[model samples]
Target: MELSTLKDAFDRASKKQKVSSSKVQEVIDQVGREIESAILKLQSVDSDQKSIFIDLRNKLVEISPMSQLEGSQKDLHIGLSKYARILEKHFNPDISKAYRNVDFDSHTVNQIIATHLYRHGLSDLGDFFMHESKEPSVIANAALKLQFLEMYKILDAMRSRNLEPALNWAATHRDQLLQNGSKLELKLQQLQFVEILQKQDKKQALAYVRGHLAPIASIHKVEIQKLMTCLLWAGRFDQSPYADELLSETHWDKIIEELTQQYCSLLGHSYESPLSVAVAAGFQGLPTLLKMASVVMAAKKQEWQEMKQLPMPLDLGREFQFHSSFVCPVLREQGNKENPPMLMPCGHVLSKQSILKLSKSSSRAFKCPYCPLESFVTQCRELHF
Candidate 1:
């Protein structure tokens, strides 16, 4: 089923819930006000018409009944239940097989999840899970935890306009960061210099520029010139010619994110945790796969589980594109070690198996299916990606 279908059901259920609650609340409030007004009237009425109190109580009973509220609640519950059933009908609960099919120790899975949670500051949840699972107090990758902890502390300090922690870290890891093609140190130093200039400390700012900005001047000459100009209008940096040099809330956030990405890259950890990446990719791909699964079930083909190749490409954006892509045009299958991609003379590519089959395994050159050029199997070069 399409997600839109399920979403429509959910929206309808939510609307029903909100409307029911609103009506119930209105009904209760109006009845309460009416009863209160009646009691007030009873207190002022003469004793000769003491029967007015009894009449007001009877009138209250007529205007408000507990059964009406119960009925509305029951109807709302029934509507929500219907939507739940519809949602459940489309839900596929067999997704565990994808992870289960991978040959990894289950205990290792629990450890990774617990460690990731702990690393993200969900200490209570992580500790509870670790204890319940009879895991050791410390994770096997305790060093990685300490590394992430130190990095997060620097990030937290950066949020408070303190770049010293990050500056110190960058200085310590200068060689490794440079080797990884990172300019994080220069970026951090530049920010610190800007922060100092914003304080109108002309002498101190120039000193900082000489010490920190001079070395990286060649690489970031234009950027440095812009920041140096901020020194001229130090008291009014916000209205300076290089107004962009003024740090923004969003700019600070970007720095933190970029630093984390670079830090993870240097340490060979994924920019995002492995579990987060996998879960995100799975969610992005699941709807299409689930629809395919439903179609396969309807046709009694079971193609979703048995098929070796998916029919379409997954456009998961640039962040997910870690390496070059070389899915063969002819076979519509991704290149693998055994059936690697072959770059033909015409610049068209195909899997090794597809080329062999298309060529009919003949000795003579065969026509290129995509173009006018013809090439023999021996002429096709293996492509790396």
Candidate 2:
């Protein structure tokens, strides 16, 4: 909503500028025409030279083009002042207000930055950064960098319609991909089959399907049937019923994303780099943090940086929420490793500390806080969030 208001303000300022420019141009043209008329009158005069000079001077004074020009310029200046104020009101250029001081290990910070750079295929920058930071360990351990480099190489090949590398990767990781409920191998072969069919090579397409796609046909019957039907529209798949689905560039993009996700999974990392996720979450929460900081300062309260958590909740989007969390209703505290949530046999949940206290640190029966059902401490299992 604030972005929309800023855009509207920008539009108004732009419109005002255009109007001011047109007004100034009109005033200049009118003044030019009056001066030209005065010059013509002076040129056509047949009277004595002194009389003609006096009449021309009087006409120039009557026209007063300088005053008109000044009025137009004043309007333009007023419009410019309003535009400046609008920009100042809508845009907050100083982000430092949202910043908080925290003690972070310089080495750890550098490692995270270097990893982010490498994860995004900026190995050159990553290497240079590690070199400058004097972090030999990061440079020496090239496993992570090599893994991402291979992923990038496969993605680069996919961009050029060369699926061989990706297909080979999928084939090598077929078992793991199937374990993760992935159809990447089948998808890659399907793309290959379509590519062959697109070239009017039905015989080779059939041969490729038999050797590569037929094995997965039993598992993905519908998908395989759709691909097989494409044989009738060989070299003219664009006019086929499946054109919208099979011929879209979106398929290539989706396949690339899938491959990257699987590759990252195999590497024991999230699809997005941890550093990138943290930065994105921080960027989204900055405005709220800044507003809170202002209020805290106005109230003469203690520094927010000293607090473990914010006074209010930050309304981050669903994408930022990566996992489920549990807060014990009995103690009104969040679950942690030391005081983890426990699920009672009766279906009620409470913190370990709460259960221990209720059961007097023994395996005795106690009434559930949330329900009338009773259960023994031993019957409660620790729940992981």
Candidate 3:
């Protein structure tokens, strides 16, 4: 594995490992080895990208404290910049003195410059020079470069349609935008971010549906067909909990019909038999059986009953022949008719019950005592004799 991937796997393992002395020591040793290997790989990266990452990391660490200074003088300057037109409008001379006393780092200077430019509608440094400013600007060239980089980041985010992060970055740099017209930048930001929340995160999606989708469905305004698609595909609802909803809800019927039709195409008329479709769909046991029953019941009652009343069909040549209605269920052959139940190789006589038992047996060793063909029982086929 690559050093980065190995480190990532170790980090994940560390997070999930049980709290214990052995586990802790094992993880510590693994991480120490990983870090040593990573350091060797780090030597091979281009110097400029490495320096950039290091500088960014240091800046993040330095600014970490500023986030905690709520209700302080620095907060007034920073927070007011989010809405106000000018730094002078929000900044107090006394607060400036206090800020100077605090030994502000390069990060703080960058932040101040970024904040000033952001509040004035000058998110993009390129556009800041277009509108001649009446107020004297004290922004350093380095700060402008930082602001330009930030604006570039927002632009990239806009192109990717990540509106939330772009909006967040825009809000932080609101002062820069108003003073300088970033018309093109703002236009780019206006592109709507499109996403289907259904597929984002399954747990979050389920929670959203339970909390939001269900209530909306109750009100009956939107077409939530895809939402039902997500639910059924996920198998989130069981027979009991979703029974009433599927029975009465118009949306669910469409989902069931579509799913059933697809299954029927794959499995043929046998699809109506719950066990057959369930097995074909890869659902085992009670849940599959329940879903199969639901599909049948949800189908048109007349059509389904007509299907059920039809006799057990036999494939004869190119056509399917349904046995006559007068045929006895307990008997495999119609008595006094040309057809009669016949035995196989060993010469024992029986009906469909015998064939069914052998075909459905889980054991491969199942041999028809009547026939020498051991384990050659074709499912529901008549004896050739």
Candidate 4:
């Protein structure tokens, strides 16, 4: 039945002597429970309960006039207003689409607008009512459009706090906006910015920064700070003035050390066998003092070949001695003591068969099966296979 007609009938029934007020209250309570139950069901990942909840809430509001006693009329009106807002906040878009061609009575339109504004805020109504005032039809259309926007904007804003609700909404509603042009416009701007940056036109880059900051600076302080940092990092601005304020002494020291080490490593030999041997021997063999010495030596030599080549599990199988960098013939699963083998960084083992295959696969470069590291069999190749 139409909401208006249903409400009219209930209003008349409440005033009739034949219908008890208790029975009217019973129906209202039952419908309210149904509305809540539908809401909970809609929270699930696979629910299609929007229509059910809307129907129940509509019935509840329609019966409110008949069910509300003398002392509860104000409370009942407030409850109806809350229901309208909840439905507009959550289910209005679907309701609008479903009844797109149908004419709405004033009471239904008023309920939908009140609900949408109460739940979604009023910012969204401006676009839909650009050509019309707050008349019933205009308000209904605006409210529907606002609901559609809120459905996405609200969920997007909530993503950092709770991901599941947004994920479920996207899964269900993304297809409906497949032809939407909003994302396409955003992508175009990103592409244009990347192209301009690639051209290395400093004049154009500054202009772009100015354009963005003019509008965004007042609205987003954190974003403005990040933008300025990026400009400084790219050498577009003088960073010396803010260096002490932005970076700690420890951070500056670490940065200098890292850059110096990298410069040295790139200039010198690729690997250091002695350093690898010391590390592979075990923590006892490569004490903190020795490790520090190795770090200094590698920095001086500008190399890291030895450190990168060391096996992931240096103390594999207690069979090999400290000086040896060869594979063992035994294979053992984790937690097994007998014939124990060590797992490599690549997740492959140095089993007798596996080691043999690796040795023969490439003369210069072969990657481990479990991890991607260039490796070659140096010693004990003949003993393994």
Candidate 5:
């Protein structure tokens, strides 16, 4: 099911849960009130079991709602169970056919996950995992940049509405941030200016703007003007035209995200964990891979690893796409540096080996498979990405 459908199912389940809980509480309260009334009557009158039983029987109608509560609770349970099953069915794809036996270095995989954890500031857990794995070559410090981890810690603080860490970082790396053309530092300062203004300290806020924000005024003239305009709102920035800029928490989120990305870039690390990126790409192509595996198994003539390239393309979105690739149709081979793709005179492309073979070792002019144009071996040009 789609995301919206899944959300709708969850909503229905939540509603059912609430209804059941309320009904159960209502029944309990009713029973409590009746029991209290019966106890009071017994204390006022004769303390006999017969008398208590008679009183309870007279007020028994109050407890009749218990049956309705039971029915409602049962129906809600059934509905919630059905909803859970639907969600499970929607998420679980048929993967039995996609299973393949391949040798994996479990140790290396563990190291990658552990390293990923370390990168994300889960050092205690990473240390535990590393020690448990007991691999001498897989020290966390080997791949880690101390500064990068520190930067991540700062970003984490920024996410928690603590900007001091980020401010200190920006101050220390001012030149580097400017070198990278990062707006994050300025954005953080702007947020601080707004925060100071939020406290109704316009004087300090103005002083901060002039002292801190003015230096970047050349690069952010329009933004500085907007901030200056926002000063008129004073303690009521929420009612200002720049309310979206001043009152929203998402700006902090954006700043933190950009800060992390820029920090990684400055430290020569990827913005995302390599293992996470790989796993995401794998999931994106999993269904297609499963189908391909099934087709190969059914045919019983080929193995997936035997192919020069995949029969179909795997679209793992723009983030995963890094470079260009070309496969030669004539030779049924992928273009490589040694045997690079070449363009024919007729606008057709093939690998160098394919051109040679099609042209009878370049003794004769090679006719394009796609057209009637022919070209000499010397005429073909190598293609580059």
Candidate 6:
């Protein structure tokens, strides 16, 4: 609601500003025209110079261009002042009150920044940062730079409609890609076949189908059949029914994403750079942390930076969730090394401490907290996140 109000205020201020500027420009143009006319009259008038000057001065006074400009400027200033007040009311500029001083390993932070740079195809900047930081030995993922450089080279070729490099890489990693349930090789070949068909070269397209696509034709019958059908349209494939599916630029984007995923998988890495994910997660969580720091921690006179666990749970989106976590229903506590989650034989989970308390130190059986089934503490197994 606040954001909507702020936006409305901004729009009003912008519209007023534009109107004022237009009014000022109109006044200036009118004044300029009057001055130009007076100049022309003065050049032509040889006998009535004093009379001409009096008439020009009267014309300027009648228009009152300075008054008009001042009115417009005043309106603009009032609108801006109101907008500034609204901004001040809506936003808190001093965020330092929410800050907490925590000790972090400088080397680890530098490595993360350097890795992020390299992952984004900024090897030169990464190298410069490392050299300047005097952490040349901290380039632990230097090999990743070369791998990402090669990936960028292939992506660059793909942007120019050249598929050779990508095709070669896909073919070389065929077995590994297949093992990962990736059909990138077939997709690349299908694109190549389409490119051939687009040239109206039925013979070459058929030959490509026979040599490059025939082996994979058995499992991908439907896709291969679609490609075969495109041969009928030849050069006019853009007008064909399959044109929307095969010729869409989104196909290239999807293929590029798939190739990147497979490449990262082969390199034993996640498709998203870890540093990027961490930053995104942090950005999403910062607001909640700030609120907590200002309201809860400040009231309690506690330092959140010195605590290992947060006072409250942060509700992040699914994309930031990489693993499962368990909170014991009995004790209402999260699983940890000292109090790990224990799965009961009744298919209910509880923290180890909860189980111990319920079963009287494994000496007696107790009913499950979630179910009526009885279970011994010895039957409960520890669960790892």
What would the TM-score be for candidate 2 when compared with the true structure?
0.81
TM-score against native, each model: 0.76, 0.81, 0.16, 0.17, 0.61, 0.81
**Better structure of 2 and 5 per lDDT:** 2
lDDT of 1 by residue, 1-385 (tens): 5779888988988988898888788778877887787767767746434676677678668866576688778889998999988877777676543331347887888887876785676766776887798877764456666777788789889988899999888888877878788878887887887788778898999899888777668877887777677788886778865566446777678878988987787777777777888778888777556656566445776545566666555567776776656777877777788888889999998889988987887577888888999999999999874
Q: Which segments of model 6 are wrong by more than 4 Å? A: 43-47, 88-91, 137-140, 214-221, 295-301, 304-313, 335-385
Clashes of each: 0, 0, 20, 9, 0, 0
Clashing pairs in 6: none
Model 2 segments more than 4 A misplaced = 1-8, 32-92, 137-140, 214-222, 337-385
Clashes of 3: 20
The whole-model lDDT of each prediction reads: 0.77, 0.82, 0.41, 0.44, 0.79, 0.85
Q: How does candidate 3 fare on TM-score?
A: 0.16
Q: How would you encode candidate 5's per-residue C-alpha lDDT over 317-340 as one tens digit per residue?
A: 888866556788977777888899
The deviation in Å at residue 122 for candidate 1 is 7.3
RMSD for each model, in Å, please? 4.6, 3.9, 34.3, 32.3, 7.0, 3.9
Q: How does model 5 score by TM-score?
A: 0.61
- Tell me how candidate 1 scores on lDDT: 0.77
Off by over 4 Å in 3: 1-127, 130-204, 212-220, 233-385
Q: How many backbone clashes does candidate 4 have?
A: 9
Worst-scoring 10-residue span by lDDT in model 2:
45-54
Q: Give the clash total for candidate 6.
A: 0
- What value does the lDDT take at residue 240 in candidate 2? 93
Per-residue lDDT tens digits for candidate 3, residues 1-385, read: 1446445544544443333335445545654555565466567756465765575556545544344333243444443444343323222223222111235565445444444454333566423532243223456534554544554465455445454555455445444543344322232121220122313345655564555444335433333544445445333333434334433335333433432333233322232434334344432233322333344435634333234332223323222223332332345445223443434444454454554466565344456654565543443234443
> lDDT (0-100) at residue 276 of candidate 5?
92
Clashing pairs in 5: none
- Order of quality (lDDT): 6, 2, 5, 1, 4, 3
